[model samples]
Target: MSLTMAILMLVGMWLSVAAAMLWGVLRIVRRHSHHHRPPLVPAKPQPVRRPRRPAGVH
Candidate 1:
């Protein structure tokens, strides 16, 4: 094969590999984000507690 053709083929292979790696990274990021999403509504509120007085100290 000619030198120019060989160079082109090498560059094409490198580009394809880079594109595949980028695609895999994006997929992983998307899946991770999907699993970590926060709830849309707030959680239930807890009731307040009143302080207790010491025994025989009133």
Candidate 2:
């Protein structure tokens, strides 16, 4: 109810909001930078071969 208490509460609320905004900005920047990275080349697939049966197997 006191003026000092009200001011403190307001400041705390402001700090919480500012911190949240900063965190969101940081996440956006990181995402943007990651998306801007060079595209990765796809790995070539090896040719498939049939498995050979053991010589002793009839």
- Please list the C-alpha lDDT of all candidates, in the order they appear: 0.92, 0.93
lDDT of 1 by residue, 19-43 (tens): 9999999999998888777767758
**TM-score for each prediction?**
0.69, 0.61
Among residues 3 or more apart in sequence or in different chains, the pairs in candidate 1 whose N, CA or C atoms overlap within 3 Å are none
Every model: Cα RMSD to truth: 2.9, 7.1
Q: Which lDDT tens digits does candidate 2 get at residues 1-58?
A: 9999999999999999999999999999988897777877779977889899999997
Clashes of 2: 0
In model 2, residue pairs whose N, Cα or C atoms come closer than 3 Å (at least 3 residues apart or on different chains), thus clashing, are none
Where does candidate 1 stray beyond 4 Å?
Answer: 40-46, 49-58
